[model samples]
Target: MSRKTLLRAGPLWQGGVSPYGLIEDPGAGGLALPAGFGGRVVARSGRKVAGLTWHAAPDGGACFPDGTGWIYVSNSALPLVGGASALRFRADGSIGDAYRILSGTELNRAGGATPWHTWLSCELGHRGRVFECDPYGTRAARPRLAMGRFKHEAAACDPDRQVVYLTEGERDGCFYRFRPGDWGDLTEGALEVLCASGGWEPVPSPAALLKGTRHQVRGARRFDGGDACHYTGGVCFFTTRGDGVLWAYDARTSALERVCDGVLAITSAPSGDLYVATREARVDVITPERAVAPFLRLDRPSGAELTGLAFAPGGGRLYFSARRGRTGGETFEVAGPFRGAWAR
Candidate 1:
């Protein structure tokens, strides 16, 4: 069956009744957040937090629950020195530990968290690859070479389907899915590209020895600057930064639809609301009712882009980063009642 592609148009966010009240002016750390919400710097480039120095060019990030508190992993996007670091938070929201998880990677960008508690840190470039990282800093990070080598952006693992959906960062990139030889194992897999004629086709060579993975498969649908992906409720959502379009792929029917426009990175709250970071230094929310509204905004550091949106366990605080800020790369946390119901 052929898939339906929907197109939408609008500003950063459409008006609607937001669960959170009006956003306050730039407060601490130049953050304009909803009432009852406050922001603080968790880490800054070249700065030390909880004794461990934070990584530079903070990109993709995610939170993992520990015994009583949680762990937040952030990726570094520097070419040669790029790696991933983690920060452990106590139950009282205090830093307990900080350390590096993955090291010696290149241009690490936005990545997704695996259901098995691993962080899929993606490298950005023609020779980019995906590295599976242990957020707890116990096991060693491994490179999943079978996932295909290309300019990777974000990855979304569908545990039910036993497959991992990935987005490429090229101007003419292809959405891909990798089916590992076995569930919970990334040792080997078959890389398939989404075809415009419907269904998926396996790429002849994932290594791209002579041809790029996106160009290896014929009739493959090309996404403009694919970035930021999330899978939930049998739907895989991804974004294309080039055209500023958000897409939803239905796993059951293999159908694709345009959800909205103008967003970069996205993360879902415990209330099932989607929070998207915008290029204009703002974060917006799409309610379960499909209503869109502004959630938070960053005031200073004009031209800085927002990314790495993640929520800590219990949904009490949200963490994100500005890859390029006025002072430098900075990761922040916004604490509020994110698990509350939407306004009627």
Candidate 2:
């Protein structure tokens, strides 16, 4: 019930065995956590709990706070038929219910929470669309049509600038920004692609920005391959899986910085630091400065890809899902004394 948070996780991941003493998970659940840290099984694919059957191929996810509990939303990346779900975490830390919050969709991947607690589920298709969803399942999913219609992958807002930065799901696709007249009102806005424009810069302007994009952030840094991105501490961090690279674009200085390589998916802690799942079947941490270190080694028998991971509001626990193999499409919550930005 009480875990000792880490003062420092020993300089990212500098070597052979983990510097921090992470005990072996006895259940053989394919995860290892630091000393004073532990995990529990919240949801598995084959189980029927809370009056709803769990779905497989769960991909991008987000966690939100509820009236007295928490809700974890995950998308199905399964081709042809992918839907979104919201799993309620009761006050006792157990699941209250799990339901399909957004239905009749395909390729639900990489969604994020708005300040208002609603979610934006991204459709990873040729004409990428973003659907606004309610974690409470109070209403039907609302499609953000004016946002853009392209191979949309990931999006995050800069609260200070009232702009939302977006990433494409292609190797040659571009990075973009959407600025609305007011904060969180994405209904009507101008969308524009980012061009390297003499060494890449973060652009803002509901007036000058393009309404959306068609993989055309002319001149901006193009990835060999990438899918998800987020905005944190004034920087937009994204990953290019093909090139195995992680990038951070500082809108303040207009500097686009490269951070990690061989990265697959990325999620940020409350501290604004990053934990990235690598193609090597391992998860690594990326500090704000771009320092990389091994966080956890995912040892799966058949070898699966870590699709998505998200931190709870306080960063005390992490929920991650993986795809492929026998135990495919499973979600796990790793609990520990996770040092949050607030801790500093």
Candidate 3:
């Protein structure tokens, strides 16, 4: 077994009032927030937003800055019953349009948004590969197979090294890294499966693991049912839904640290603050120091689980999907005096 440390940030990540103070929702939206905070129903499963029904079983998603507006990519978790869709939000934070991508793909799962303003949607139920396309949801001529075809859950990029870290959403899922050949281009890359220093053989099968390619890693930490991943400040986080453990990976030291627990979706704010959406239906904010606290809790009449958590490039707004038990699915955008990098 590898070493594990309990995450406890000193004071910096403790308590600080953001410019966006506690705001209360008007009660119309399902979300119950602090004061000054506001929310809007961006889209829904059976209903249409910009002419496209909100994708079913919305699992993982991300938002990309698009000129004065933004493009939000959503993933569907139900195998063969769902697909990936992209919703374009106008400058005013309204849905301008929506479209389909990853068509013909199975179980479009969790993924990360690339700096290139594209979506790296993963196929969790089928080919176990990631399909890259514009936020508009165009069909990719080819998926980035070099990233390895596995039971993947999420992928986050280290903008500095131009490398991406991927997670396999399995009971014994292995962490991986895809180093692209050219900067900013994910078309070609080398795939490496992680393992212990004393052990090698690339886990079960490098061919099935990498789907037939060679390549990286010595830190074989425990990642049970790794579900969501986010990279920032030389640290990457993996939320293992099965065991409800959060694994924090340090690129600088190659150290894998266990952070929080009972977290599902991990979205990194532009300012480097990490937001965690929990199965408990609450959103917690984690500061650079790793201190975490509940940020938002949603109340649904029909019962639901929060998913597809994403922060806008401007950081003033957040878009996420709420799974409404009998009512179906819903998409929402919460905005306030959020603190972070502004749109350039």
lDDT of 1 by residue, 75-114 (tens): 8888888989999998888889999999988889889999
The full ranking of all candidates by lDDT, starting with the best, is: 1, 3, 2
Candidate 2 regions with alpha-carbon error over 4 angstroms: 1-27, 198-212, 215-220, 288-291, 325-327, 341-344
Among the numbered candidates, top lDDT falls to 1
2 against 3, candidate with superior lDDT: 3
Worst 10 residues of 3 by lDDT: 1-10
Give all candidates' CA lDDT scores. Answer: 0.86, 0.69, 0.71
Pairwise lDDT winner, candidates 1 and 2: 1
> Candidate 1 clashing pairs?
none
Residue 334, candidate 2: Cα error in Å is 0.4
lDDT of 3 by residue, 1-344 (tens): 01122233443344555333453553786577767677778877877778876677777898877779888888887766656888888897767889887677767668887777778888775337787877765546258876776777788988877788888876766777788899678777676666655222333343364442222243564467778888766777778878887777777666766665678887776666777888778777776555566677777734677888888777888888887653367778888766565742
The clash count for each model shown is 0, 12, 8
